[model samples]
Target: MIDRDTVRHVARLSRLRLSDEEQETMREELSGILEHIEHIQSLDLDDVPITTHVVEVENVLGEDVPHEELSVEEALREAPEVAGGGFSVPRMG
Candidate 1:
């Protein structure tokens, strides 16, 4: 069980300025959370497989298939800058 002193110490370590009422509330909540965790720890999980999610997810992706190729002119039709028969821009060092 989370005591008042433990709650105050935790709050101080976390740089929190909790009031007396808030500290009492936090103490009860933390104690409840620990109790729940203890109950969960007592459960039998040997038959359950560890998973990231409850539902099974798969990558339902389609096969990559190439289509008709685009010509240089068609490709550079809407380009802002054009160079020597290709897309051009600022020079890189």
Candidate 2:
């Protein structure tokens, strides 16, 4: 069971400002989630395989092939701003 104190502590750790009603709602919701997890833990699945995903997946990306490299002048031709033979971007604080 999720207690009010636990909920309050979690809210504090997450820097959340919750009203009294919200804290109570969170306690009930968290308790329900824990109950569901407990039910899942009680399931017997000795023959079930451990899998990250439920469905089979295959790589859909195209084959990697080497391509001709672009020249420095060609690369910088479309730049909005260029400096020192490279693209110049705005400075970030």
Candidate 3:
């Protein structure tokens, strides 16, 4: 999400002086735009053969039969946050 500070920075670069209300509005709009772009970029289109139209793209995926390999306490059971044995998030300022 775009922050208020980012909105202010953009306004400054564009040589604009926005009111607080306008800044908040721009923040929401720009955040939405960026989020939409990110969602598009995250789509898995590897199976879609670069067509100009949209229809019949199939990859149905299901053929990797390798099982039984979760030993770290059954992969941290139902971890919401496991520390040293993997997966523990929240540290990005």
Each model's lDDT: 0.90, 0.93, 0.88
Taking the tens digit of each residue's C-alpha lDDT, what string does model 1 give over 38-81? Answer: 97788899999888877888968977998778988999999999
lDDT of 2 by residue, 1-93 (tens): 989999999999998999999999999999998997887777889998888877889858966998778999999999999999999999985
Better of 1 and 3 by TM-score: 1
- Kindly report which residue pairs in candidate 1 clash with one another: none
What ranking emerges by lDDT with the best candidate at the front? Answer: 2, 1, 3
Top lDDT prediction, candidate number: 2
Error of 1 at 41 (Å): 5.1
As a whole number from 0 to 100, the lDDT of residue 90 in candidate 3 is 96
Best by TM-score: 2
After superposition, candidate 1 runs with Cα above 4 Å error: 40-93
lDDT per residue for candidate 3 within 1-93, as digits (tens), equals: 889998999899998999999999999988888987897787899887766647777768977998877799988889898988888999986
lDDT of 1 at 15: 89
Give candidate 3 regions above 4 Å deviation.
43-93
Error of 1 at 64 (Å): 37
RMSD of 3: 13.3
**Lowest lDDT 10-residue stretch of candidate 3:** 50-59
True lDDT of residue 88, candidate 2:
100
Question: What lDDT is reached at residue 43 by model 2?
Answer: 84
